[model samples]
Target chain A: MTFQLIVFYSFAAWLIFSALMVITSKNSVKAALFLVLTFASAAAIWLLLEAEFLALSLIVVYVGAVMVLLLFVVMMLDIDYAALRQGFVNKLPIAIVTSLAFFGLLYYFITHGEFGPQNYANPAPKGADYSNIKELGRILYTDYFIAFETAAVILLVAIIAAIALTFRGRKHRKAQVISKQLEANKKNRLKIVSMEASIEETENSGEQEPSTAEEKS
Target chain B: MTSSVNFSIISAEIFLLVALCVIMIVDLFQRDKERKLTFLLTQLSLVSLFVMGAQDLGLERQVGYSEHWIKDQFSTVLKLAIYLGTFVALLYARPFIRERNLMRGEYYLLTLFSVLGMMIMVSANSLLVVYLGLELLSLSLYALVALQRDSNIASESAVKYFVMGGLASGFLLYGISLVYGMTGTIIISEIASYLSANQANLMIQFGLVFIVVGIAFKFGAAPFHMWLPDIYHGSPSSITAYISSVPKIAAFGMAFRILESSFGEADIHWTPMIMICAMLSIVLGNIVALVQTNLKRMLSYSAIAHIGYFLLGLSIGNDEAYSASMFYIIVYALMTIAGFGIIIFMSSENKDYQQISDLRGMGRFHPWYALMFTLIMVSMAGIPPFIGFWPKLEIFRLLIADGQVLAAVVAIAFSVIGLVYYLKVVKEMFFVDCEDSPKVSNSRSLKIALSINCMLLLVFGLMPDSIYQYCISAFASLN
Candidate 1:
């Protein structure tokens, strides 16, 4: 029990420290990395609470997909960091006050509120045969089916939105028209000569047959 | 609370989803010249959705899909409004898009998807479902706002919208998490019952505050309204027509669903914050609009003020007040669509006529169009004998009924100030004249559509009893 408490406290401390670093980091990329660390620590805490599904998802989804996306955006956009920092001093007092108030309230609740070991006893350990993913799947497919489908639809919309934003059509650019090329038929490319054989013009001009026919006519 | 999910209850959503996919596929084969076919298909889908929603009306409200989805008369009304509003907006968008060479299939497809998102939002019963729907809607909107890719302003607006929208959604998710932790439920109805059975906690109140901030941002209420004006001005006016009207109705539905349904018992905790936002929006929206020359930006501010009035009704927190707010949003949407529709009609080719001076001498040349514009402006100004007057009157009536005399007076005073800018639009059309006569678009269909839209405002103004009653009944059936 003491060991468990030590692990929980350590993870919680790490989570808070990384979260603070996520905000206070000077570089945007560093901030994003710190955010990932914060998420990882939070997942560790969730695992300790027996929320295996949430812990795995917190690592897989946030650290895997969302953080990567954030990193891409941060790298893509050339942000003027100097301009961002310029207002920090001017806004410092209000920011500090608001954040302190928020922290104080949170601390008060955690320390004084009716939230303690009595309300949140350690969850029973699962049997060796137990599977958290299977439980999640069961609930998701049955009770939360609509929610799951809605989430899928949101993902689809995000994909569509990304494509729409990035897709550019340049009409003037030179590209192979394979379909148009393949659609050229014999009637369009070749015509049968129904006139008499203009042998003299053919020998002298070695020119196109259509031109020879027109000249002969 | 049933374990088995009923598929028939959400038939409209299913149909919409299938139709959107089919439209996207069909649009792939259509060339630029044949884009009208895509437009017609989209419109047909919208009309069918409206019919489906209409047929579902007056049915018993049912919660299905393990209570994460709901089908109620209130959602039905809001969904129907969204469908009808989109239909009108797309009809107005057609000529403008064609002239600007923006008749891409993606536009229609994205719009249909966004509408689907809105429908989901209106019917969502769980906070998670609500977040998903809101994200879908906003993601599509961010792309739509940046559709004019070459324009720097459009790109800038899209970026701003994305960042602000992301921040708001974060706040909302945090609030949802806190609420879930407090009550051990994510379903709105269950949350309501839970809160009613217990005393409100500080954690829940904090969650409610964040939720209120998120809602205010979505509604473009003051202090959180920085994104609204720029987005309105930067987007193509066709998209502006959609963004300015349909989404507001959807937002109101979302607010009602979350606040009145889930947090109804905790109203006292959230009311003061909402009241402050309402007051600030009204005071700032009208006062800032007075100095704007860009017609779209002015209307954007006017939208903020209108939300202020809508929030006024919400703050009162009664059946009468909820209905009044509903009626106001519907009325406001109608007037706004017509207002932006005229702007769309005036735009020829890529040259958008959105400035106040663009309407100069238009009254002399196109008397009928000008008259339509006049009616819309007067309605927006909250003048008598127009539809806008009724909703405002209803709000004020409810305010007075609830013994909020100070709120009523303050709202009335701001609205009077709002009248000056609305009249300025009319004055630009009539009193001012330019030497060069701007050519009026000869699209008879758009003219006819705008005329009908404007006439409905006046007609409904004259006979608001039925509509008002409909609204009252819709809210009365809410759990």
Candidate 2:
């Protein structure tokens, strides 16, 4: 194979393997990290397709932002996936059948259907000076404005969901409770008490006191 | 470039977004435990939105923003209904949240966002908009389910919903990618036109399967409905009520928008699948629900069965049946909300009354509320002279008329089976006696809201054509 061909096939293989691991890995953190690998390899594939902007975004957005958020959720929720999977064997047959059927359908389409290379012809090689990001941005701002705004709203919703679900405000956070702070007075905020000392500490204090008295004399 | 961006048409959405932000800022400054101002502001905006949606109804169907946003009778009517439902839900939610010390402003904010998302879904003209709207709605719902953070059950339920919802979304996104790859377009109207003209290829068929799965999952139809009961049982009752009611309309709208837009001509493929889900959901939801003692869990299974009925109406592939399904969802929201509201009502600061046994001697102690509860449960059971009966009647009639005789018979049978549990609750409330006197909710506003909600069922059941005609006219362009 040519160099580019070798690179693509290798990345594609990596993409598939990692994607499989994403589901099969029992540890959620491992699955999440495998998801990052999946995204990275997918982005590499996108770069091979000469879509530079998409590759970078796939890295910056999905791998960086979305995966980080997902990791946080996995850490925060602490769901018992093991307990959730208590009846795995009983469900395995049906799940396997469903997945295999889907796979078979996809296989049929990939091998024998009209959704083929002829229907989606590859683009001509672009000049090195070309910028798809600029082109994509033009349409994104002008034509797909509504979809863009809706996406922005969805992001806003994600933020609200995160804050609303987990933020405990003053309870768990070190946030100052203004009312409690304001209500604090000298007696409540500070405590001063006279106490009898233990034997050693008392004797040490007495000696120190006598020395200080001698010094005063 | 700006020719198609009709700002006034989507001004309602813009208004809501701006109002939501304003409320957020205002709430940030508030120290009030009840969040009274936030609630008032949210209700006021929802009222304004209801009026706006009403004004927009019956207008000529308008497409704007490069045909990405649509304003038509189909959307406007549903939007109005959603607005009204959310208004009542929040009013009922107030005391419930207050009692539990969960009365943060974020509850109203998330709910408002969810409302905004539903409105977007109804009016969305493109697949991208539909996906985004679905995400906004679902994310808010998941958060709201988990809002009572101190409860272990609530948090676990939220986790379950989040996972299932994410899987459903993934299925939908995969389907969307396949549809786009096959059709070379993401505009829903263009996709519809194309699919109507050409035979679907193998990939399109595969994609439609995923789409249907996603739709069924969102509707909580059987086999894909693993998450509904646990969530309903585990979440705060007020949140359970909210999720059960307003979002059903949005789900109906999303399914219709996607299915009708993507596969109306290829109905032969998807129809059988939906019919199967309907029967499965009906049988499973009813049978499993029969054993539930907790009213919330029982109502959740009932919700699943109701989804089956709604799906049955929708499967007929005609304007009349579509409207019938629309009416079913709207009425289901009403009946279900009132059903859950009674449970919310039963709770005071100390106790949450959710068991069927909790209703023991309620009729003996509080006759007026017991009558209201009876009406709600009976309506949910599809009894006559209640709003719930009309939708079921319409679905069965339309199913038979559509020549699906066996499906119709199966649905009617399961609906009868579903009635037993509701009647069981009614029996517990009226006949079964408890040694201790019942402690009904003392919220005046909640009782008033619940009364109005339950009464509308009987009033509209007497003359359902008032709502039925609106549903019919909303789909006037379908033929």
Top-scoring candidate (DockQ): 2
Residue pairs with clashing backbones, model 1: none
Poorest 10 consecutive residues of model 1 chain A by lDDT? A198-207
Instruction: For candidate 2, give the docking quality class from DockQ.
Output: medium
Model 1 lDDT tens row, B240-327: 9998899888899899889989999999998788888999999999999999998899989999899999899999998889989999
Q: Give candidate 2 misplaced runs (Cα > 4 Å).
A: A1-48, A58-112, A127-129, A171-217
Clash counts per candidate, in order, are 0, 0
TM-score of chain B of each: 0.98, 0.99
Tens digits of per-residue lDDT, candidate 1, A1-217, equal 6987999999999999999888778999999999999999999998887789899999999999999999999999999766787888789899999999999987876766665445676668988788888998888898888778878887887777777777776778898767669979999899987998666655646657779799999
Q: Per-residue lDDT for B1-479 in model 2, tens only?
A: 78997998899999999999999999999988778999999999999999887888689888888888888889888998899899999999998998886899989999999998999999898888999999989989998998888889989999999999999999999999998888888788989899988888877888999999998989899989889999888899999999988998998999998998668888888888998898889899999899999889899999999998899987898888999999999999988889899999999787888889989988888888889999988888898988899999999999999898998888888888888998998899888868887777788999899889889989999999989888999898544
lDDT of each: 0.88, 0.89
Global CA lDDT of candidate 2, please?
0.89
